[model samples]
Target: MRDYLIKATAFDGQIRAYAVQSTFLVEEARRRHDTWATASAALGRTMTIATMMGAMLKGDDKLTVKLEGGGPTGPIVADAGANGQVRGYITHPQVDFDLNDKGKLDVARAVGTTGSLSVVKDLGLKEHFTGQVPIVSGEVSEDFTYYFATSEQVPSAVGAGVLVNPDHTILAAGGFILQLMPGATEEIIELLEKSLEKIPPISSLIQQGKTPEDILNLLLGAENLKILETMPVEFSCSCSLDRIKDAIRGLGNEEIEQMIKEDNGADATCHFCNEHYHLTAAELDQLRQNGELQ
Candidate 1:
């Protein structure tokens, strides 16, 4: 099935939950970045969670999740928009290691525990909303859960998982986010916590052909869950050749002239999507002229 996300409310709106199946998008990322097994798991987990977080916003709001764990994979970054669009990348995509004792991809080793996870949100406001939390666990989900509890002052349960195939392609990737709304009763919280302990790993459930709705039913019970909305999710990068040209133009005339004199043309590649763009000598001249007008 195509990738998508569902937003739901449970326990009479006392709990907010989101679930997503991100297999296709994660696979796209693996192919684009040529990530190894462990690196694919790390990037996929981050992107999966970012997609759900994106659904938490409205309108043109967007957010960026930067995870700097000081591991061999370097930093992992995911950019997500309210419309269920997300794109992400890892600084070092070839990082991999033997599976951990649990026989799971060694994500914690690929993503060290020395750094922090920070989120910057552009809500179309005067100042962006920024929150940060120390990396409690190199595991992506725990770090995000801690971010929500410590930085945002919201009690949340975040679980994201990615299963990579032997050939380094993503086999399954999905996640769920559960948050306690204000005035959540003690009984409801207790029930939710108990349910969490019994649920299977999100990726495993997705691999078993479970839909987002089914996942929520397992979490909050079918009787208490109310589906609010569903939206298609994908790996979407907001980079374009025109945007690259504008950036080159912003570098000023001197830089453009130097490029024209020394290199004849310019080549640019997007970090998020790995799409390359070549600027011809004539294009460089035009950009320089455009810069002159500004």
Candidate 2:
């Protein structure tokens, strides 16, 4: 099915939950970046969770997640907006390795045990909000879990998984986030923890064709969950030729002249989408005139 995300609350609103089925979106990303199995898993997981977080924002608000783990993959960057859009890329997308001890992708090894996961949120305010925490496991999910608990001071449980096909495409990709609200009793917390442990991996469930609703039913029980909102999610990038052209103009007339005089043309590629933008000599002249007007 098409990728989507669900927002819900359970146990009489003591617990807030979000889950998504992101196979299609992940496949698109894998195809775009040509990521290897392990790298695909890592990037897909981050993108999945970032999508969910984006849904938490108000209109025009957005956030960026940056993970620098000091591993072979270098860093991963993801951006999400209130409009249910997400895009991400890893600094190195061709890294792969054998399974971990748990027979899962070796994400921790590939992401490294050092470095940090940082987030910058633009809430339509004069100053953006920034939160950061050291990488707890280098597994994307646990690192986000730690970020919520430490950086945001919200007790949360996060699980993200991505299974890759032998051909390097995405087999499955998904995740869930559970947060405890104030006055949540210990009894409910224990029960939810047990339920999470009993369920299969998020990727396995999505691979089996489970919907986001089905995932919430398994974790929070069909009888208890109160569905709040459902939003379609996908791989979307806001970068475009116009935006790149504006950036080139922002470099001022002298830089544009230097490029036109020496390089003959300009090439710009977006980090998030890898979409290349080429500026011809004529385009550079136009940009130079615009810069002079500025």
Q: lDDT tens digits, residues 58-114, model 2?
A: 899999999999999989999999888999999999999999898989999889889
**Which whole-number lDDT from 0 to 100 does residue 124 have in model 2?**
90
TM-scores, one per candidate? 0.98, 0.97
Q: What residue runs in model 2 are displaced by over 4 Å at the alpha carbon?
A: 291-294
Q: Name the TM-score of candidate 2.
A: 0.97
What clash pairs does model 1 have?
A: none
Q: What is candidate 1's CA lDDT for residue 218? A: 97
What is the C-alpha lDDT profile of model 1 across 126-216, one tens digit per residue? Answer: 9999998899889999999999999999999999999988888888999999999999999999999999999998899999999999999
lDDT of candidate 2? Answer: 0.92
List lDDT for all candidates, in order: 0.94, 0.92
Worst 10 residues of 1 by lDDT: 285-294
Give candidate 1 misplaced runs (Cα > 4 Å). Answer: 291-294
Which candidate ranks first by lDDT, i.e. highest? 1
